[model samples]
Target: MAELLAPASCPLCLGGDNRFYHQDKVRCYWHCAHCALVFADPGSHLAADAELAIYRQHENNPQDSRYRAFLNKLAAPLSQRLGTTGLTGLDFGCGPGPTLSLMLQEAGQQMAVFDPYFANEPEVLQQQYDFICCTEAIEHFYQPAKEWALWLTLLKAGGWLGLMTKLAPTQDEFARWHYKNDPTHVCFFSRETFLFLAERDGFTVEFIGNDVILLHKKALS
Candidate 1:
């Protein structure tokens, strides 16, 4: 039998250990005692190249109407909050084809794109931004702790961070969840998780959909 690793702690809080989560032969999710995020065991995951290949199969086109509409659900509201000033934004994990950055650019926000598998430009990571969006991307992070810290540091004071990912419903449903079936998706977040993350990261969180969340830095003024 595979010996279980030490009790997992909430990656967001690092204070509370997971005690209420479950697991199986293929994967296990643990409820974060501090932040409430139920994530997969890092030891059990796919390789980077293999994961990228899975993502590459996605037909992501900048001009896809339905895709644009789905993104607008988050973009429209975030855009409204920004007012008329053209702010710079970063689209983290833009994937093989970046559509959200295009949409934001069309909305008058100057956008920069970055993707580990697609647009892996080193310079894009050097500049800070007024805002950042990570649609359907956070779930793939192998280093959630490091990546999140870097993301927070990259945002200018009072900037917005938008994220979209399907929230986990129940542990039972998680067993059959098609979203988890995707080899690239490993990290999972719940509303409690987002709230915990926001508070810990010094931002405020708003839920837009089962899969959409907006986190804003505390107002400086």
Candidate 2:
């Protein structure tokens, strides 16, 4: 029985560093003390096809005014940071319809898009960009370390990375949170968690509004 019940490793924790966080009707969660990342049990994750089915239902097209406004939360800040037009960008996870890329393009940024399910352009992943925006997508990461490494590799020196995901609420509210109810949402980040990324990985972080986070990479001298 002891052998059967091995230590459970948190997906975001490299050394399996974690503590039991919370549980709901659907799944269990783990909290990493080092980064303050709340992650779901891997056993509860949706398979690729199942996850794709859920994504397929999102109406994230260019025609949706509401979606454009939501994206503007991150885009507006990022546009201001860029300060100039014609900079290159990558919509790290543009979802099914790819509207944010279109929005930034309209703002005068050259944009490339990559979505594991919808726009799987291998070429884009091989290149670095002036900025990268990943909205409402990091929560679905099962192997967040690898993804983080990839993002760093794909960003130019002094580049900006913008993210828009609902931050994890307090432990008291964890069970009642609607964001965690989604089967695809496996990883959650707090301000502390993001700060850990910035301090450890060489970047500066700023929170915008309730959900948007901006990280600026160190520039080459």
lDDT string for model 1 (1-221, tens) is 55566444555556557664666667766676677677777677888888877887999888889988888887888888777658999999988889999998988889999887889897988988999999998888865787788887889889999888898778778777788766677778888888877877789888876877888898667
* All-Cα superposition RMSD per candidate: 2.0, 2.1
lDDT of 2 by residue, 47-157 (tens): 899999999998877998998899999999999999999999999888888988999999999999998888998999988899999999999998988889899899999
User: How many residue pairs clash (N, CA or C atoms closer than 3 angstroms) in each of the candidate models, in the order given?
Assistant: 0, 0
Model 1 lDDT at residue 9: 53
Please report, in order, the local distance difference test score of every candidate based on alpha carbons: 0.81, 0.88
Off by over 4 Å in 1: 1-3, 7-12
Worst 10 residues of 1 by lDDT: 6-15
My TM-score estimates for the predictions, one after another, are 0.90, 0.95
Error of 1 at 120 (Å): 1.2
Model 1's lDDT to the true fold? 0.81
